[model samples]
Target: MTRKTKPSTAAAVQMPLKEAEAGKETNCDEDKPSDHPKERDNNVKDNDGTKPAAEWKLPRKKALLQFRCKLEDAIRGDYLLGRSYWSLSRLSRENMSSASSQPLPLMDIRLWGVPLLPSKGHEGTDYVLTKFLKARNYKVGEAFEMLQETLWWRRQHRVDETTGEAPLGPDELVLRTMYVRSVDREGRPLCYHVYGALEDREVYKRALGTKERVEEFKSWAVQFMERVARRLSFKDGGVDSVVQITDLKNMRSRSAKEARGVLRSTFLMVQDHYPELVHRHIILNVPLWYYTFHLLLLRLLHQSDKSKFILARPAKVTKTLLKFIDPEDLPVEYGGLLRENDEEFSNLDKVSEVFVGGNTTKSIRIPIAEAGSTVVWDLTVVGWDVSYKEEFMPEDEGSYRVTLNRSKKLRESVRNSYYINEPGELVITVRNPTFKKKRVLYRTKFKPTVPMYVFFKS
Candidate 1:
C-alpha cells in the first residue's frame, strides 16, 4: 500500500548552474573606509550618483526574472557541487520540460545504471525518487548508483519472493526476535525488535554458516521490511513511514556482541536501500554500554539518520512512547492498554501453563471444534531462546501450512490471534534449543467463532 499522489504538470523550476559554480562577490562600501578627507569626499560623491530609492525598482516582468535568477543562484551557492554535479545538472535541464508535460516512463527512469519503476499499485515513484535525490544532495548519478546497487542486491537474493518461503529451524530463532504486531495512530506499521534476545554466538554462526544461508537471512530481513512497507498508504491522508521500537531490556555483554555483529549490516541495508522509510526509531531501556557503542555507530550514519533516533530509559519510556503512539495502540508491557485482562481481551477465554526443560520440544494440538472459529495464544520465555511455531494440518489431502514461526530469547511475550480458515488441527510447537533449562509460560484460547462488530444509531 504505497502512497500515491496525482502527478503534477507544473514545470520543475531550474536552478542556475553557472552562477552557482561561480560564487557571487558583493561589493559593499562599509568594508573599505579611508581616513583621508579627499577619499572620503570622493566616496560620498560616488554614493550620491547612485540611483534614487524609487528608481532602483525594475519592471514587474524584469523583477520576476531577477528573483528567479537570485533564487537559483542562492541554491547553487549554498551547497558545494560534488563529482556527479555535471550529470545532475544535465539531467535536470533535459527533463525539466518533459517532466512537466507528461509522466516519465518507468524503464526510462534510470538511477545510475539501474531502472527504477514503481511497485505494483504504487504510483508515487516520482515522489520516492525525489527522496533519494535529496538524500544524495540532488546528485542524480550518485543517487541512481546507490539505488541501482540496492536493487541489484535485492534481485541477487530474491528479496521480493521471501514472504512465500519458509525459514530453516535455526533461522526461525533469529526471525522471531523482530516482530510486526500492529499499526500506529497514523496508520504507520509498528515493528518491535529485541536486540538482547538473539541466540548464542556459536549457534547463530552455525545457522548462518553458508553464504546461501546468510543471504537467506538477509532476504528474510528485507521481507520483514517489505511487510512493514506494505501497510503504508499514501492516498492523501495515508502514512508512508514506519515506526520501529527496539527493546534492549536484559541485555548482557554476550547479547551486545551479537547485536553489534548484525546491527551494522541491518543499518546499512535500511539506510542505503530504504531511505526515509523509518519515521521514528524509539529505543527503549538502553544500557550504559549502548551509549559508547551508539556513538561509534553514529560516525557511520548521515546526520539525518542521527535525528530520527529517540532514546529513552526505563523512567521515560512510557512518556516517550505515549508522545508518538496512542495509549490504545501501545502494548501493556510499555504501559499501554492492550493486554490480557484489559477490556478488549477480557471476553477471550484462556488456557495457561508453565513448562521447564532443556533440549526438549513441546507440542500442543488444538482441535478446531468448529469452522470459522478463532485460535489465540500468548507465549513468554525466561532466561533462554525458544523456537516457536504454529501449523495447520488440513483434514483433507492438502499439505500442512506454517501460519507462524519465530524464536525469542528475552523475557518478552508474544501474542497472536488467527481466524481459522478451514476446519483443521492447529499445532503449536515450542523447542528449547539451548543447553540450559529454561522456563516457558503460555496461554491459549479458542472461540467457536470470531466476534463481529456491532453498531447502534444514536
Candidate 2:
C-alpha cells in the first residue's frame, strides 16, 4: 500500500541552519483578504542597486484552466488508476458482489483526504491540483511527475503513519525547536521555527552531528509536517496552509554549515512534497548578510516558493510579523500579547488598540468597583520608545493614590497584576517621546479567589 521515492533538488537552496523553517510569511496569497498589507515594491532597488524578483501572483484563469485540462488527461492515463491513475491508492482490483465478480468500475482515489479525480467533483480538487501545478509553474508534465514522486515518497517513508516525538530518531529538543503554536489572523496554523534554540551546542550536535543524525532530523521534519497537515482543512475556501515564523537570532555560521545538509534536504522536501502548504515563511532577527542571501534566493527559487518568504531584521522583527499576524495570536517575543503557559488571558479576552501620536500621550483606565478583586493586564506598545506607568486611583479621594509603577522607558510588552480592595480605577499612562506614532494593544481582566479554608475538605 506504500512506495518510496528519493527526492532530487531541482533548484538552489538557502535553508535556515536551525530548523526546517524557510518559505513562509507573505500576505500576497490568492485567498488573503483584500485589506492585506501592501507589499514592498519589488522593482525598487536596494542599497546594492539590484532589484529583486517580481512579486508572485496567482496564474491567470486561461493558463490555469489549460494546465488543469492537461493534468486531467495525464492522470486519466496514469497506470496507478486503471491505467488512468485518478489516484495512487487505487481501489482493490477484485469486486465484492454476490451476483458477479467484475472489477469495481469506480476507483477510490485520494490525496491528503481530498479526492484527486477531476471527475470526482470534489470542491477542493481544483485547489489541491493547482498547488502542484503552481509549484511547477503550470507545467503539466513536471507537476504530474512531482505528484508521482510525492506519493512515492510518502509511501516509501510511511510518512502518513508518522506519529509521536522524533519518529525517525532526532533529539527530543529538535522536535521542540519547531511546531505549531497557534493560528494566524486568517485561521491558518502559525508555526514557529525557533532556530535560536539550536544555539545550544549539545542540542545542535544531537540534531546535525553526523550523516545519520542529519537523516534522522530530516525524517523528523517530515513527521512534524504531518502534524501540521492534520490541522488543515483541504476543502474549498478552507485553510489548507501554514504560516512559518522562523527566528534566527544567535545562529552561528558554523552551526549553519553543520545544519546545511538537513536544512537543504528538508527545504527541498517541503518544496517537492508539500507544495503551496506554506502560507508565509517569516524569517526573524536576520543578520546583516540576510539581504544579500535573500537576493540570491529571489533569483534562484521558483516564483511559488520564493514569494512566501519574508525577512525581518532585529529591529523590524516585530513590525514585520505584526503585518501578517494578529496581536493576540502572535507570541510576546514578537511584540504580541501572547505568552507561554499564560493563565491570565485567552483569545476571547479581546485586546483593545489605541494610538499615541508622536510627542503625544495616551491613557487607558480600567474601572474596578468590586472590592477584594484582582486586576491583571497585558499591554504592548509596538516599536516602543515610550515612557509609561500605572497607578491605582481611589474613588474616595481622601483615601490617597498609590503609584503602582514609576514612570520608565520600555522596549517590550508588559504583564502585571494588582489587588483592589476599594472602588477605584487602574489608570495606565503612556508618553510617546519619539517623532512617530505608537500603536498599543491592551487588555484587562478580573480574577476570583477564595480563602484557603475552601481546600480543607478531604
Candidate 3:
C-alpha cells in the first residue's frame, strides 16, 4: 500500500452521467434543434431570447403557428380575465379555490417577463409560448387554453402587484423548511425543501395550526415560486427552470396528514401555474414509511411531472446528490465541500479527491508555511465509516506536533479552522478498514490574520 500524503485525485469518483453536460434543453421529441448559422453566431442580436429555428417537426410547427394565431385572438377578445383556471390536464379545477376578487385587463399580457402578444415579434414570445405548447404535448387548443388561463390567473390574482417581498411573505416556519440554496451542475437554481425542519414543535404548530394559516402558507409558497421564476431569463437557451431537492429524513409519520391535506393543494397549484419550470425533482433521504405517502401523492400528479421525479433512499442521499451537482457547488450537509455563507471557500476554490485502497489509510497534507495565517478545510469520505486523524506538523522536526483530532469515526462531511504561528502542514488521515476501496474529497483555504503582536505596535 502506498502512503497517502497530500491531496491526490488518483482515486476521485469517475462521474459516468453526462446529462448535465448537455447544452440544449431536452425539447419535445418532435424535432431536433437545428444548427442554424444565426443560432450559432454570437453576434446575432434579434434572436437573443428566441429558440433555435427549425426546432419543431412539421406537424408541431404547423400546430405552433396556429397556436400563435389563437393567442392573438385571445388578446383581442379579452378572454384571459375574470376566471380561475387550473391545469385540467391531470387534476380537476374544482379542487382549486376561486379566482381573485379583482378586475383585470386582458390586453398587454405577459407570462413571467415575456410578452404574450404574438404580433409583437418579441423573440421571447415564441420561446415562452413553446413552453406552454410542450406542457400540453403540442396540442394547440389545450396549450392556448392553458396560456389564457395562466394569464387570467396572473391578472385576477394581481400577482404582479401583490407577489412582492411583503404582504404574503414566508414566515419563520417557511423560511426554515424551504430555501433557495446554490445552483446544480447545470447551473439551474437549487430550491431545497427540508421537510425535516417541520419536526420543530414550533414550526409544526405554525404549519398545521389552523385552516386559515395553512391557506396563508399556500399563498406564500406560490408567491415565493413567482419571485424565483421572475428572476430567471425567459430568453432562449437560458436557465428557465429550478431543481428542487426534498429531504424527508426527519419528517414524522403523523405529518403525512398535512402532506395529504395542505401540501397536496399547494403542490397542485404550483404545478398548475408553473408549467415545465422544475428541471428536476430530486427527493433525498426518503424513509421506508414515506413510500406509502409517495404512492398516494403520485395519483395527483401529471405524467410529465411524474417523469421528472427522482427518489433516493437515505443511504444514497450523498451519492445521488453528487450525480447532479459538482462537489464544489454542493452544500456541506449533502456531502460536498461547499458551505453556505462560507468565508474560506467560494465557487472559485477547487476541490480535489483521493482514493484509498481497501484496508488502507490515506493522509492528506495541506502545507501552510506562512505564519500568522488561518487555514480552513473541509472533507468527507464516500460511504464514510472510517477513523480519521488531524494534526499540525511543524516544518522543523524540533518543534512539537499539535493534534486537532486524535481519531474520529465520521459519517458525514466536516469543516474546521485553525491558526498557524509557524511554518507547518495540516495533515488529515482517513483509514479504510473495510474490504472495499474508499474515496475522499477535500478542499482548503487560508487567509492571513493580524497577529496579536502586530496589533500592539505603537
Candidate 4:
C-alpha cells in the first residue's frame, strides 16, 4: 500500500537524442510507428517519404491492423525494459553489499557518458543510497502500480457507490509506475522520471529545501540508525547519497544559492530537536514498552570528534540502561539522589519520598515508555512483589521495610500498589500472574511520602 507523489519538473528525463546516443534507438516501428506507417488520405508521407496523399490513402481496417501490430511490438519492448529494472536492482544490491573499504565504484555509476555525482568527497550520498536501500530492499513501482490498479478495479465492480455497499470479494491493491523528479533546495529544477520509486526522502528533502519533509525523514532515519547502531553495531553505514539539482550553466546568482543554503542549513540544524515516536504496529497480547536513546547516543558519539568508537558494553537492555551514565562520573549529590531513589535501596514497607517540596515537585519525570499492564502494588508494602509481609517498620522519614512470613497472620495484604504515568493504555496487557504457573509473590513495597495531591502545610 503505497501512495507516491508526483516528481518535481527537474527529475531526470531522457530526451530522444540522449536515448539514441545511449544505443536505445528509436528506429523500432513500435517506438516510431508514424515513420513507416501506410499513409492516410490527408497527404501524409509514407515510409519512402515520396508518396502523394491520393496514393497513400488506405482502408480504415489496414490502419487499425498497423496500429495493433505496433502496439504488440511496443508491449514486447516495454516488457524487456521493465524486466531490466529488476535485474539492475539486483545488481545494485550485490555491488553495494560487496563494496570494499576502499570506496563505492564510481565509474560504474555513469549513465550515457554523463557521470553520476560522486560519493567519495560527499560521504553523505554514499550512506544515504547504499544503507537505506539495503535496509528496505528497493520496491518496484511497476509491481506496486499493478497491485493498486487491480484493487481499484475490483473495488469499482464490488461496491454500489450510491448505496454504500460492501465489497463482494477480497480487495487487493496494485501499482504500476512512478514518476520521479529532482529539484534543488532553492527550487532550482534538475531531473524527471517516468517510472521509479519515491525519491529517497533525505536526498529529496535536502535538494528541495523542504524543512518539514527533511525532519520527517531525519526522524525516521535516526531511529533506523539507532537500531543499526545497537543491534548490528556496524560503523560502516551512515548518511548515504546526496543528489544535487542546480542550473548547469550558472544561470542563478550567488544570492540565490546563499538563500537556499540558509534554508537547507536550518532544516539540518533542527533535525534531532524532537523526541522519537515509537509505536507498536499491531494489537498486542502482552505488555510492551519502547524507550529511545538515539539522541543521547548521538550526543555521546559526537562528543569525541573522532571517526571511530568501539562500544564494548553488553547488549542487554538493563545493562544498556545502566551504561547511560558512568557511575564514577556521577556527581556526589546526584549519585546520592540516584541511590536514594534506587528501587534496590528503598525498603518495600516504606512510603518513599520521591520528590522534595519546592517550586517544582517534578523529580524523575520520565515519560511513560509503555502504557500496558498497570502495575499493582500492595498498599501496606512498596515493592514489585508483596505476597508475604508480616510486619512493617519505618526506616527513615518517608521510608519503610517489611518483613514477610506467609505463615503469620499479623500482616495485612496491600492492594492498589502501582500507578501509571499515563492512563488509558492498560487494556492491552494481561494482569500479572495470569499466564505464568508461578503464583504472585513479593516481600515488600513503598509509596510517595507526600501523595501527589497532598499540599505540604508550612
Which candidate comes out best when scored by TM-score? 3
Question: Model 4's lDDT to the true fold?
Answer: 0.24
Per-residue lDDT of candidate 3, residues 7-124 (tens digit):
2121110110011123333332332222211122132111123334344346766676777777666566555442322232113224334354222334455677566666554545
lDDT of 2 by residue, 97-206 (tens): 33332222223445665655554344455557667866776676677778878866776676644544444344457557777776766667787767777788987777
| TM-score, one value per model | 0.48, 0.74, 0.79, 0.16
Question: What is the Cα-based TM-score of model 2?
Answer: 0.74
Task: List pairs with backbone clashes in candidate 1.
Answer: 3-234, 111-144
- The reply for model 1, stretches above 4 Å from the true place, is 1-122, 167-175, 199-217, 340-458
Considering every candidate listed, which one attains the maximal lDDT? 3
lDDT of 1 by residue, 1-458 (tens): 99988432111221221222244322323322112111111111101134321233334223323333332332344322223434544554564464343322322332222223322112233334544544564455566566556655654454543444555235466565677654565556678876545445565565455666566556656777765555444222235557788887776655456455456667677778877677777889887887887888888887767777889986567668867765445665775545644532431234355574778888767777566778776655544367777677667677566566554444346677777767777777778877876555455666666445423433
User: What clash count goes with each model?
Assistant: 2, 8, 0, 48
What's the ranking of the predictions by lDDT, best on top? 3, 2, 1, 4
Candidate 4, residue 171: lDDT: 19
Worst 10 residues of 1 by lDDT: 38-47
Distance from true location, Cα of 302 in model 1, Å: 1.1
TM-score of 4: 0.16
Every candidate's lDDT: 0.54, 0.67, 0.68, 0.24
Model 1 alpha-carbon miss at residue 385, Å? 30
Residue 69 of model 2, lDDT score:
55
